[model samples]
Target: MRIPRCYEPQPMNPGDSLMLGDNNVQHLARTLRMRAGDQVLLFNGDGQEFHATALEVDKRSMQVRIDSGEAPKRDSALQIHIGQSLSRGERMDYAVQKATELGMARMTPLFSERCEVKLNSERQDKRLRHWQQVAISACEQSLRCTVPQLDAPEPLDHWVRSVEADLKLVLHHHSATPLGDLPRPGSIALLIGPEGGLTEAEVQLAMASGFRPVALGPRVLRTETAPVVAQAILQSHWGDLAGN
Candidate 1:
């Protein structure tokens, strides 16, 4: 049977005892209904996971004892940073989750002229937390040792000017170049737009900022789907997924 992995904020080490809190405690006690001596894996976003056994279960917290275990090997070789235009509710969450699973080093939610969703400072903060959790859950599911970083959301124009990537791409249906045309770089950045897509002026702005326009295929993909496909293709081309 597969033991469930949990993300704990506290530090973990062999022979250490820790208590689960908040939703994590509730998840272990209620949802998983884990009994004493049940095996579970725990990680703290530190590129290592602890082999743990539940020691006690109560209303407030579930306690576990960590055991000596080898850390999981890192899977991604080429680092990818995704700059994605904000989409609606579940759409954005899906993209963030999949990007984490695909081994993105960092993520930034961008605001383009054609974007339909707009957020104030408060809403942006809440969304950033939500996206980080989505990424965490994805890492747990994929058994990734490292969690991807989620950067603060910024306007398309400003973010484009600030990034200095070894390879940068802005997805456009009318682009002449394909991602396959470029040699793999140590670090790559992919910029994808929302449903209505980026305006011509915005495309020109991206181009002027040193971002090459790359087309995925003949058909245009949905905002959420585009990043997943693009990341998978790039990974298979030069990252760990290659030759596998």
Candidate 2:
């Protein structure tokens, strides 16, 4: 059987028994009908994963005995922080999910002029939690023991100015620059626009803040597709995804 990988928040020690969270209990016990002695993999986002077997299972809760810990080395060497303009509905979720699987180190959703989504403080918090769960789910599927970072949504200009990286790039097809011309950077900050794309003024603002305009190719990609394509290129050339 495929051992299910799960995200647990509590600290883990080898050879210890602990209660899985309520959510996990529901999923494993009630939903999946998983019984005692089934094997599972658990990680707490502390850069290691614990192999465990269910020790007890019941309607309300479940316990697992931690067998051993394995540290995964799958993270990209190139630390990328995506300052992506917020798109509405599932588009934003899609971006976060794919970007995490692509090995993005950090992400900040940006409120740009072209962005259509609007949120009050309460809604923003809820959306943040939803997006975080999306990323966590991606990590479990991708076998990444270390979870990617996702920050609260902020204004585009503010994020552009504050985001730090060895190389900063903004994807604008009109620009003459290409991704291959730049020297290898240990870290990269990539800026991508929303559905309608970034305004000319907004692009200029990012350029003023040290983000150089670069294009993935001649064709213009959708708001949700740009970051994934850009990340693949960067990782292939300079990051951990590169292979012989």
Candidate 3:
């Protein structure tokens, strides 16, 4: 059986016993129905995987004994930061989840002028937590040892001006440069618009802020689809998926 891996935030050392609480404990004890002696993999986003064995399982909590640590092979040479306009409903969630699986190091939800999804204070807080969980689940499913950092939602104007990356790209259907024309970099930043797409003015603003306008071939991809396709192509060309 494929053992389920859990992302634990606590510092772990070899031979240390750890106790899991909250939803994670409930899922392992009740949902997975895992019992004592079953092996589990644990990671703390420290770029290492912990080989652990279940010591106790109950409705209240689950405990595991850490055995040894093994440094995991790095996933990608490319460090990508995605600055995406916040779309409505599950569309944004899908984008965040897929980006995490594709090895984006950081994500910032951009609140653009054309963005239709507006969150009040309470809703924004709730949604941020939900998005964070989505990222965590993606890491578990993808077997990624490091979890991607999801930043607090910020306005597009402020975020675009502040993000520092070796290369910055704004997805535009009319832009001259295709992905191939750009210079390769160890780090890249991608700016994608919301459902209605970026307004012409916003596109101009992005261009003025040192973001190179680029196209993904001739096709116009949806807000959610663009990031996945772009990241896959980038990784295949310049990241871990390359040369294989």
Candidate 4:
């Protein structure tokens, strides 16, 4: 059987007997039905993975004996920060999850003019937590030791002016240039608009703030699909996806 990988929020040392709390109990106990002596992998988002064996398993609790730690940071050298406009429901969740898989260094949920999703402070907090969980799940599945940073939601105008990167790009289908014309950058700040797409004025504003307009192809993708496609293109061109 493929060993399961779980995220633990606590700091851990090799050889420690760790008792998992409410966070991981249900998943390991009921969901996976892991039994004592079953081996598993654990990570704490500390850029290391631990080889662990199930010490105890029950309905309420699961204990794991951590054996050793191995550092495996499956991160791209080209740091890419995705400024993604917030979409509704699964669309937003899909974007975050896929982008994490694509090796984005950070993600900033953007509130744009055309953004359809509306959230109060409480809803925003809840959504942020949900999004973090999505990223964590992605890391576990993708074998990425380090979880990507999830930034608090911010307005488009503020994020555009603040993000620093060697190349800054805003996706606009009507733009004159393809992505290949650009200089190779060690870091990129990529901006993707909402479902309705970025208004011409917003695109102009982003360009004024040092973002260059780029095109993906003739066919336009949905908001959720755009980030995953764009990140793949970028990674293929200059990031780790181009590996030997």
Clashing pairs in 2: none
TM-score, cand. 1: 0.95
Ranking by lDDT: 4, 2, 3, 1
**Predicted structure with the largest lDDT when compared to the true one:** 4
Would you give me the overall lDDT of model 1? 0.88
Which 10 successive residues of model 4 have the least lDDT summed?
Answer: 235-244
TM-score of 2: 0.97
Residue 166 displacement (Å), model 1: 0.8
- Residues 72-126, candidate 2: write the lDDT tens digits: 7978778999998998888999999999999999999999998899999999999
Which stretches in model 2 have alpha-carbon errors above 4 Å? none
Residue 35 deviation, candidate 3, in Å?
Answer: 1.4
Least accurate stretch of 10 residues (summed lDDT) in model 2? 235-244
Give candidate 4 regions above 4 Å deviation: 242-244
lDDT of 1 by residue, 107-188 (tens): 9999999998989999999999999999989988999878898988999999888987899899999977866578769898
lDDT of 1 at 79: 87
Clashing pairs in 1: none
| Candidate 1 total steric clashes | 0
lDDT of 4 at 48: 92
Q: List the residue pairs that clash in candidate 3.
A: none
Clashes of each: 0, 0, 0, 0
Q: Which scores greater on lDDT, model 1 or model 4?
A: 4
